[model samples]
Target: MIKTIIFDFGNVFINLDINGALQHVRDTFKIDTLSDEMTAFNSLYEQGLISTDEFLEFYTENFPKLSKEELVDVWSFMLKDFPEHRLRFLKQLKSTSKYKLILLSNTNELHITWIKKHIPFYSDFKNCFDAFYLSHEINLVKPNPNIYKFVLNQNTLTANECLFIDDNADNIDTAKSLGIKTWRIDIESEDVTNLFNVKTNLF
Candidate 1:
């Protein structure tokens, strides 16, 4: 019996063009590939180990030709629209009160700020979850066993009783290794609104 449902924010909720964003960054930087240092900086930023100002400063210093506003726009280009049907489904699920709803997302300040500004129903969507954990705020990231452990421990939730849905294969694999049921959603073809129909056995 699954008592709790954990959801990933990107792709599972808001659409993300991850590859597109990376291509944009590469073009802007005139680089063929992202360096190991750049990847490390991104991880540090996501973990909240660095401030937003510091993050911006690193980019501004490296790409002196780009203005602050341009940097922000490129950084946030990956995020896309949040479909209304998904929000409706989530709201309905919350109303049922049959399962504990939780949202776990690997997100940072600038991205979330863009979400709040673009998605008008951000609060309504947020309130549907019993608990919301953002990586930057929590200083815990996915594909990491410690973060999954933190969620289970903090909520007093047994891994077997929780079903996590994410678009990332590594994240799903990590959750499964911890004895948590998971769905690695196909963002290109599947809709989260079909959760009950798709995972009928779980229900």
Candidate 2:
């Protein structure tokens, strides 16, 4: 039986326009592509290998023309609204008391700060989950077997007893490799509201 339900944060809980952000950064910064150094830096940031300040400093040092505020805007442009209806759905699910709800998100500090500011019902949404895991906070990222193992080991949950939901196909594939049941959701048109149709607690 499924005893835990794992949810992805971006594109799942809050809407993220990855293409929009990339385009915005390119247009705003007049950059055609991310530098190899920047790419490696981002990987480390996502892996929580460096502090937020260090990440921002790396960008600021490389692109000194852009102010920190402008850089923050570019970093956060992909984050959009977290609708209340979704919050209500999660809240109702929380009341079910049938399965443990957990949130696993690959996000950075700048984006999270934006969420805390813009998403009015953020706390309510967070409260619905028994565990809230962020990549930056945990120093581990999705699609990595170690992170999934970390969650399983920490929660004492077997892979067969957990349902991992993520919009990223690679992440879903990784979870499935660990024997975790998964739903590769489409975030733009479909939302977690579809979870209502899922019969939980079934082996």
Candidate 3:
């Protein structure tokens, strides 16, 4: 039986336009793709290896034309409106108290700060999760085996008894490799509110 439900914060919940954001950056910055150094800084920021000021400095130093505000807006372009229905569903689920709820997200301080400022119900959404693990705060990003291991170890959870839901195939694959049940959510057609119906076999 699945005793715990782990969720990804991006498309699985708040909705992220990853492709759109990338395209926007490429067009605006006149770059076809991110350089190795830029990619490295992004990854480092996500894992909290570097502070927010340092991350901002790296971008500003490289892109002198962009201001700090502009850069932040660009970085947050992927984030869109969070549906209240999802929160209602989560609240209902939490009320049940049947399964342990967890949120595992690969995100940085800047994105989180932006979320907190925009999403009014951010605190309520967080309260639904029994345990909240942010990649930046924990210094462990997803798709990495060690991060999954850390969650399992921290909660003393049995791999088979946990269900991890994410929109990323790589993340889902990694979780499955560790013997954890997973749902690779389709952000477009599927709604997380239909979790019980869609994943009926698991329930």
Candidate with better TM-score, 1 vs 2: 1
Would you list the clashing residue pairs of candidate 2?
none
lDDT tens digits by residue: candidate 2, 82-133: 7778888888888989899999989878778888898888888888988899
Q: What is the C-alpha RMSD of each candidate to the true structure, in Å?
A: 0.6, 1.7, 0.7
CA lDDT for candidate 3: 0.94
Each candidate structure's TM-score, on Cα atoms with residue i matched to residue i, is 0.99, 0.94, 0.98
Clashing pairs in 1: none
Error of 3 at 9 (Å): 0.6
Candidate 3 global TM-score: 0.98
Candidate 2 Cα deviation (angstroms), residue 147: 0.5
Off by over 4 Å in 1: none
Per-residue lDDT tens digits of candidate 1, residues 1-203?
99999999999999999999999999999999988888888898999999999989988998899999999999999999999999999999999999999999999999999999999999999999999999999998998999999999999999999999999999999999999999889987888999988889876
State in Å the error of residue 89, model 2: 0.5
